[model samples]
Target: MIEVIDEFYSAALAQETIRGMIENARGGYRNGGLPVYGYQNVRSTDGNGNQKTRYEINEAEARIVRLIFELYAKGNGLKNILMHLNDHGHRARSGGLWNKATIASIVRNEAYIGWTIFNKKDTKIYGIQFKPRTEWVIIKNTHPPIVAEQLFNRVQALIEERHPTRTAARTTASTYLLSGLMTCDRCGSSYGVTGYGRGKKYAYYNCLTYSKKGKQVCPGHSIRADELDAMVIAKVRERLFSEFNIRQLLNDLNVATRTVKDGRCEQVKDLKRRLADKEARLLRQYEAIESGKIDLSLIGDRLRALKAEQNALREELANFERETMLAPPVITRAIIERYRQEMEQVFIGENVQEQRAFLKNFIEKVVVGESETRIVYYAGGIRIPSGIFPATSEHPRP
Candidate 1:
């Protein structure tokens, strides 16, 4: 404990020292030996003959960078840009042909707009960790910009539009869709599929926390996968096609739109306005410092605090947008019938992964206990007996 505390304090001190240096460095480039592609270093000697490196635009490479941003902003995909550059005999900084990933990196770089960001990543126990935007150190107009600020902002907007936040894991061919959906009733831990018996033909869902951490954490909660899956499918099919449930869902959506959605839209608008205000304030501070109306030292703490607030606002704004975009669909009778038919076909004829995905759409969670299993559907839940099949010698629990 003492050693860990000492190490933590040391790290904190190091981070603070670096932050101070960056705030005071006053638009000087501080590369940790990584070469930036489009810029050449400009060396300067201090009064004491100590040398420092700064950045200046390399026109030839800067032209290529400009072309990349232009192509991307004009609706060219990364692959198209890559092939265009490579086909024209253009090469990367490493003297290799351009690739899709390289084009993506160039497009995402803020250095093209004369902005330098620090503390974007840190070394962690597992690997390099990308730190949140709140923790980043940003220096604006640090050097000559290849792209206009308006163009850069537009590019960033396009990137965000293309990639939205995900609430669930991406589906893969081999992944069992329902693997992480079940939980242990006792300990509220995820249940994993375990295979047992000769040749491991039988699959059961068991509490992973209990298996790995012993009974101190959770008791054993196990159930055969086939029986549970069948029960779940039956329950979903019964509830989904019912006219009463469909009407209730539509009524709930109407209520949400009337009461919740208006308030949420107003909140989102307020956040956006505040974000714009903060950005404008940052720009004013920069202008003040450049015009000698305010000292750089005086504004350091304020700038960091403003940036942190802006980052937080951006996160909240993203959440609100996600909630708005992924709002519950307004289900009409026709839509419900079509959905029911598709679901039935998928459950009967599709693969296990597809069936699991179908289940996830409506079922929020499944909790397994000793004698009963509770399934919480998106609209509601139902409790059923654990063992749906008669116990036999071949299917005995461990």
Candidate 2:
């Protein structure tokens, strides 16, 4: 505990120091970092008598900023803009000629429009990473505006149109039930939904390796997505997840669990120890806040995280105790029957996510061949159980 407390305070001091500096930087107060081009960092003392830095527009540089926006919006590419700026009497604040990246960055920066942001990124052990915009502290109208908001919006639209991003919309827009489970038998590549139909509304599951690399890599094997999905769902519902199969699987699980009760005491003790540690750490943070050893605002995020961990630990500890002391649920024939009925409704229902879960539970993977498909079951799950499906197009039994 002594060594742990020392290490925690060292980390806490670093966190608190960085957060205090960011809090002081809310209204464009600089922290010795280079200000964006067209803005100069000027030092001044705040009302607290502590010296700080904030951005003020450098007019000579501001004119150059406005010119870049105008030129880009007029259909000028980065190359032309770069050449135009360097050929003329313009250079970076470092007195070096401007490059394409420098020119492009000025056009994209929001600092020119008089809004300053702080805590937009965090530095972890790996490297710098951007925080979500909601977490960023944005102070508007803090400095004099150089370019109009209208110009910035126009430039942004052009930038997005030229270099479009993928999967921003398509990720949620396209959902497949057997996505992770379905694979091609020929090349062992996963089948994913691709292409649009006559009205750009329908898609198909094409072999990923073949679709990406062409027929020279593999055959152009494609299947109508709806047909394959319906067939697989039917097979899973009628064959694999049948009530007889459900009952036998539960019986097997209950028998297996009865023999495995000897190894749980150590797990319970370990969880109790972990739970106690989380509670102690949470208490320390609370004491620090009450005793004035730490600022609440600086430690609020960490405090919430610790409280969440405490809650999760409590839930886990309860589960471990219940499992060790109390018996497992009496999984009777009536209980299995009720579960089977609910599963039937799950497949027939409109909730695709629920249906997907049930399918993944019953079957491990589906290997799609030219003439047939193979459904692999989780072991000890279904009767007629050699532990694998061993079915073809002519005869696919559950």
Candidate 3:
């Protein structure tokens, strides 16, 4: 019975997703997330006052789009195009230099030629598994085209002829430990992952500007992922999970709880105001009944109800005040030891993705120089568990 119900729920969710996507596509509306780099989302109202997101060309970005298509058509590979863009100071929509995958995505995106394609991947499964092209919902000329259909098709042909199925380093993009977290110590441009393929997965997050824009912009610097991931993991386990650091974590937790407690204090204040208002109303009612202005037989139930509400408010207010007065929990030795063990397991565990996530949370930014890598800590920072800077630890590049 549970399995049957779960299957039904899965089917219903898939249907709803497809239906909503198709509806949005047919109506020429841009669905959520970031719009393609060449386009910006403009909100428009229909006759019935329904606000719809419409894709409008961002002229500056469109020029970059046209240049990319033209360059690709002129026999430039993804790396060459990426280098050209970075060398010329052209940044991605997210304020980063163009990687090979970014360039490939722009080339393959149907929106360039004004088509809205949906259902590219099956979302019903536990992991993202892409659906075949035949299973897609494609609407033509949904918005203005950045490039001609002829040019777009030519680029697609070139991509197929050159790369086949976009294998090599691109396929292993997710496996890199420090893909997005590291930045160059010299120029501050992000590090791009490369140097992996041909059955041997050699991982390195090299400086982007150095790779694409030449050494003039930023020096050629690269960090070995396996060694650095190990070192950083060790440092985080030793320092971040230490009793001193756990105390900072508890402080952050207390600060967040205090915010909630302050909100409760305001709630208690509001309850008191409400109780006072109820009492004033009761007094006015008593005076009226005593003066023979209102009949007791008629107003007696209302007076009783007002008194009941007043009592309820008083009880609620007292509970809230008591809660507000309670002190935040202290960081105990047991908590620190337990947290240390759990954190050690997280790093020691085989989940690279999980390790990266935790690293990004505690470590503010990792600045890799020619000689040493500097890690800035936000041990008391981040949302939920805010942090203070414990230390800016540096280690020689392995």
Candidate 4:
């Protein structure tokens, strides 16, 4: 019986998804996913007050996309293009640092050439499987193309030529604790390490743009790697793990966590009931017309109007359910104490790779200036003056 019900539910879901896909294609709207990097989902109402959603270009992100294409077309390697973007302090649509995979995805996507492609993959009980090119449903001229067709074509060809075998490269794990998390305030690019010495490393975090593109692009912002890391470690110890700060952090986290409200829960239930009632009433009215108890012509417009209302109510119910279902993280005194005891050791004792992971969990980004580096934590951020840490530290060496 359970298996039968599971099969039925899957069938129903597949049908609904197909309906949604067709509607989205006809309406030229984003088909229920994260808005692509250079686009945003715009929700509005149609002439008869029917809800509609469409993908519109985000000019800021679009400009970055164009720059990527331009640079690639001008014969820059993938890594060089990535460096160029990071050097300029440009972030990916997701607001993280630029990477080769992201650059490759943008270069390969046909959407930039004004196409909405779907059904390129199939999801079944096992998992997702890629569909053949023949099965893909592509709608052309869905919106304004960010890149010209010629330019897009050229980039695609270049990508194919550059990686003919399409083999994935094994990336060496980063040893710098804050490699990608740190940003250069002067030129907006991510900071990278350079200048090693005789068995004694002289690593420093310098603007990637200045390191590669030259001082013409950025004034060569830099900080000694050891000094910066020590400062960050000290600040983390001072701000996050301090007794007063831990209590405050816990309080803030507790507040930020979401809770479902009774009002919203009630609203969801009410909307569902109303939708069912409205559908039943409309069905009976149609039946009456079919049975000749009511004139079809007289109630045709009313039936259409009622159906539209049903769709609107369904949308409203979905929105309510989504918002009410989010639950916040719970922090306790015990957890705080455990974290306080372990954080210092984790930051100081862990190898560079492990330290990087730890930093990502708490630090959002580090903006480095000439005199001060603003350490942006995931919770918020704190600024500390540069050149303040000792040349060395009691912290365990990696």
Candidate 5:
């Protein structure tokens, strides 16, 4: 019991001494006088001397703290910003490496926001250490802010956006050729690429919804990567070489306007009816407001909603009428010739990026069905369908 009391007194004395030294240094620095700097090298008669590491808040070190705070505000998460600093050979305050915990501490420190909190955690005698937020002593405006409060809040928001509590692992790279251009005809969902087995062993593209869950959600429709590639190459070759297929595509596109004209006319009429109904509602709201039948607040809200609906309807009606009246001319032999020449250039292009660009420009989507696969081509402001059978000899080609 006596020894324990002695040790406690010694610790208390040491802490007091350190506090007095820090206060003296701070006062001397404030008064434009030299601080006591030789304490680190002060030797005692005991072992190893008092060789300790001391830190002084020099202008260069302060500048580094400011730089770190600025980086945190610029839409970079703590981990990434720390990595960038470390990569550029920036060392931490203790001349040590940077880690996630250190970066997190720097971000959460209120000192950067021009405030300091002391005694956040405390220990009394031999009892367990305890810290209550309400007991913390906060000193406001203790230091200059390195980043604005608004910018810091935005950085926090971005951090939360990137790291949600529950998130699925992002699998594929964004540069896949068929990424947004393929769909399942049965479920009308997009197809996704998946890999199987271990490293360099196996990989394939399957219906994403089915692969992640089960076949009950979707029938497991899949095509081998190599097989799909070959099919697309063959189709491209055939389309380029075969004169008959090229002519048929052009003729079909030409005839589409005449065949869909009646349907287009009905669509325009329907849009006009919708526009008239919306306009009638808007006029009714105006009359109610004019006569003071409704409160001004309620009338204003209703008027705004009605006006928006009427504007949308008017826009739709105008679009329908324009499309009906100004349909592109029917695909002709000359048009076919020009398309063939363009396609040939794409087919024989040495650059992969150019080929993918051409394919994306012409093809909207390729829908894979159980029995038939349909390629939707974007031509003359319409999606022209080209049918292919997976069971048959014909393969996919762009």
Candidate 6:
């Protein structure tokens, strides 16, 4: 009796399971046997000579590409283009506002040149995608190019040219003369200027790194507007009076620079020799790989290190050429005369910016400590240290 009951229950369960399977199959057929918002059927050939489904450019995307190229050709940088589009009430295809990331994407994309690039990004551990340049597969002239190859290359060059070297924020109005010139004596970083109040405001110059990083990183030293002007004027006068000392400094600099010329030439030759040796080694390694005596994988690591060394040597050689071989004679009398004329104008100048500019041209780095401020002036390649002034002293306002 128990066996019979168990058989009956099993039969019922099997029938129900079959019914559910049939319903699922029918539903799947009705739904086209694919996910809603499924990936579009893309006709593309893979590296392994197999057809693969991938996203292709649409008409709207092609128009955007053309627009980007046109904007780039007009000397509008990526940021400016993005800002202009946003300001003009232009929306992206996704109906979203333009952003830096989107602008960068449009600028960097090479697909506008009729090439199809794949595998720009891949999934790494559990749903995390990483984009690697090395893994990109490029198919040349896959579609009609919206932008010409030459035009695209020029746009790319322009983009790279506009990339900022430093992160110093630039103001629309040029105010300070020594805005970008002043450097911190302690860390050798540029000084940033800030102002307080409205018209007839008090402006101060402080080390940028220290201001941003706080006093724990660097002791914040400041030179007030009036104090700096007086100090610079006094130093100029002092240097003018000591004519003999000024001439001696210039003569010494000239002699020292000339003496080092032969050494600089020898250094350049040595660097060239080292670079040649690396190139020969790289060539030999390539030959070994071709001959099946060495593994090609090891060559990459060796070449990277060798290339870095060669680059360093080349930089040193360049520096030697610039400093020793190309250094002009530093005439102290001429410098003094120039400084005196500038200083006189600076003292009476109505425009603060002009005054600051004159001072900046002569002063290299002004080190303001707790007690004294030391100003270093660079004439040609030689550095002349001017008189130290008390940091607490007051003077006429700009």
Which candidate gets the maximum TM-score versus the true structure? 3
- Counting only residues 3 or more apart in sequence or on different chains, how many pairs clash (N, Cα, C under 3 Å) in candidate 6? 0
Model 4 worst lDDT run, 10 consecutive residues: 389-398
Clashing pairs in 5: 231-396, 232-396, 232-397, 254-331
Query: How does model 4 fare in lDDT?
Result: 0.75
Candidate 5 regions with alpha-carbon error over 4 angstroms: 1-175, 196-202, 245-345, 348-352, 378-398
Candidate 4 accuracy as TM-score = 0.40
TM-score of each: 0.42, 0.39, 0.49, 0.40, 0.30, 0.29
Residue 391: error of model 6 in Å? 8.1
Candidate lDDT scores, in order, read 0.73, 0.71, 0.75, 0.75, 0.58, 0.58
Q: Worst 10-residue stretch by lDDT in candidate 2?
A: 389-398
lDDT of 6 at 120: 63
Model 6 ranges off by over 4 Å = 1-174, 195-200, 241-343, 346-348, 352-357, 379-398
Cα lDDT of model 1 by residue, 1-398, tens digit: 99999999999999888876675345465554564778888887645676767788888898898888888788765645665676677778888666555676777788888888777777674554668889888888777888898887888777676663723322322344357678888888888763344455656667766544344446566566667777777777787767796777667656776667778889999999999999999999999999999999988999999999999999999999888666655547776567667868997654887878777888899888888888888777998887663322332222
Which regions of candidate 4 fall more than 4 Å away from where they truly are? Answer: 1-5, 93-96, 122-130, 164-398
Better of 1 and 5 by TM-score: 1
Model 5 — TM-score against the truth? Answer: 0.30
User: What's the residue-level lDDT of 306 in candidate 1?
Assistant: 95
Cα lDDT tens digits, model 3, 92-166, are: 888877777778778988899999888777888777566888998888978899999999999988777766355
Compared with the true structure, what per-residue lDDT tens digits does model 6 show for residues 1-398?
99999999999997787565444323221212221111222455545675544434466556666776788778865545565566566666667556555666666677566555545656555653547767665556644556789988888887666656544333312465455655676777677553322342455666665544334345556665455655555675466336685667667766776667767778778878887897788788778989999987867888788878878877886887677657655556677567656766654577767766666666665665445556667753222232332232221111
List the lowest-lDDT window of 10 residues for candidate 6: 29-38
Cα deviation at 381, candidate 5, in Å, is 16
